[model samples]
Target: MNKENLFDTEDILSEGGVRDLFEEVEVGEGEKIVKQGDAGTDLFIVDSGQCVVIDDKGAGRIIDSLDRGDVFGEMAFLGGELRSATVRSNTPCKLLKLSREPFVRFLRKQAVPGTKFLIFLERFMVERLRKADSLRVLISGDQDLSGKRGLQQLRADIRARNTKPLLSADDPILSEICHWIYARNDQVLFREGERTTDLFIIRKGEVVVVDEGAGGFLLGTFGANDAVGEKCFLDGKPRSDTAKVRGNAEILMFTRDTLVELLERDSSMAIGLSLGLGSLLARRLSMANRTLRLLTYEELREKAEVSRLLSEMRKSLRIKTLH
Candidate 1:
């Protein structure tokens, strides 16, 4: 779950020929491995020693430390975006770099290993997403829960006509999971902390996830072909948010046990489905990180305003004393 000690490098990288897939880079202490705001096209694994992920705003703050077998620069494989934070060598280090293009080719060629690596990556990002979500709440004292448009855009990207969504297509394999059911308006699909492993894929209309942990703040709004409650389904963890039908909606509801049966029955279908879910998870994590950064700056602004108010209070008291 935590980034460190995530992969058994030899087992994961070597078994599937993942070891040959990455190009190794050696760095001197204090060397920059990734620069913030630069286009990220590769994911990195700490092969030896350590690296520090740092915030690039003013005096850099260390976000996290990467020890052997840890992953960083993963935003690259999740799909291209500017690097959110900078990673630099904390000591002389060795890193394995995995570029997007070659990794895709590797996945196409190998089946099970690709699925295995993707499952590993999905779990890793989920942990990161939860950590970032908690940090945002800590800084703001409440979750902002105002990124409806942004979250929708992420789902749209996955469902673009030309794009294959991270969710499985409605096929024999998918039908085994669940069939479409017309859910009514005001339907409570699931609640936070409820024991449910159902993965919902909206076919028509809207479903919104409310963070009951944040007093029912709107966490995410998802629509057609968008997967929801996937984090719980993937990790077999309890639901962290409540999902409700915004309008009379049609959706496909699948259970984790059925999915596991599919995995056992057909390796290729299972891998493809899992990979798609992994991609969707990556998109969600990306949005979560960006939102956390904005929250950080927002907290700074509030602190400055508080200081100014204190200064004005002091001046007003001094003037009243003189009068």
Candidate 2:
């Protein structure tokens, strides 16, 4: 098997890069590197020996194996949540670890590269989710239900009635993956920091995005055809913001299993989907960068408050380290 490079020589040549940030650590055989449900802020990359990723739910099934260059603990590191799985060294292992604060600092200093890194990480996470979902399908012996007549009936109805259908009737890839859901007013679709495998598209009514870090602010209201949960779904992390229905609503849900199956059958469709999502990510990142270029007075005040919070957090971390 080919090994993965954590950082290229060019990246290492740059001052204060990821190569300079990670610290080396050694683990004995049968040692647990990370425990499921424990909050983790560091990401680890295996340098040598072997490790195993095990899901602790119901008798501890082994999800995957990690050899040289494999990375773990990234989901919790990126989402600021508890670990989803346990990683244990199968043999004496050499590892490189990078903590959250330094990673954030590196990103701040290297904006363009950092954005590309995030995209790479998102792609990696998506592959991992697909593998997990596919494994579940194999173990359960579940049949693919995409050939159901109900979906064809729904597609026909959408074509005749809806002027702007979320997926075209001819798009078999999407047709196989999408299913309808109903939601009532004030119903929570998903809460912040909750892990989920499904993505949604609103077919009717609206939903509000509530972000607590922004002081319970309603970031925006999304209406028909708007996609929610895609960002975290793509990144394989917990939801970053809470989504609640504003009124009676119809939604279309898509699962990672369907997408993986689609890719297995048709590679071109997968490429097209990735390209479309990649462009959306690029536009969103550009807009965010533009917003950071100019801040209002209130925005400036909020920024200062964020800095103050970070200061307090650093002090708390220091105290913990001392003890």
Say which candidate scores most in TM-score. Answer: 1
The pairs that clash in candidate 1 are: none
Among all windows of 10 consecutive residues in model 1, the one with the lowest summed lDDT is 314-323
In terms of lDDT, the poorest run of 10 residues in model 2 is 314-323
Model 1 Cα lDDT, one tens digit per residue, 1-323: 22122222225654568668889899999999889989868888777887887879737977567777777766557656578778889999987788878877777677556655666666666666655554544444544445534645544554463246544555776776566778998799889888876788777788998778877766667887677878766565788778999888988887756555665667666666776676676667667665544443444435654334322311200101111
TM-score of each: 0.75, 0.42
Give the residue spans of candidate 1 off by over 4 A: 1-15, 136-164, 168-172, 257-272, 296-323
The C-alpha lDDT values of all candidates are: 0.66, 0.56
Over all chains combined, what TM-score does candidate 1 have? 0.75
Expressed as tens digits, the lDDT of each residue in 1-323 for candidate 2 is 00122212123323335457779999999999999878877878787888887768526977578777666766556545467678899999998888877766666555334433444545554443333222222222333434533534433432333234334425765666667778999988888888885677677888887665445655446677555676765655677678899879988776666455544565445433433343333323222222222222223324544344322311200101111
What would you estimate as the lDDT of candidate 1? 0.66
TM-score of structure candidate 2: 0.42
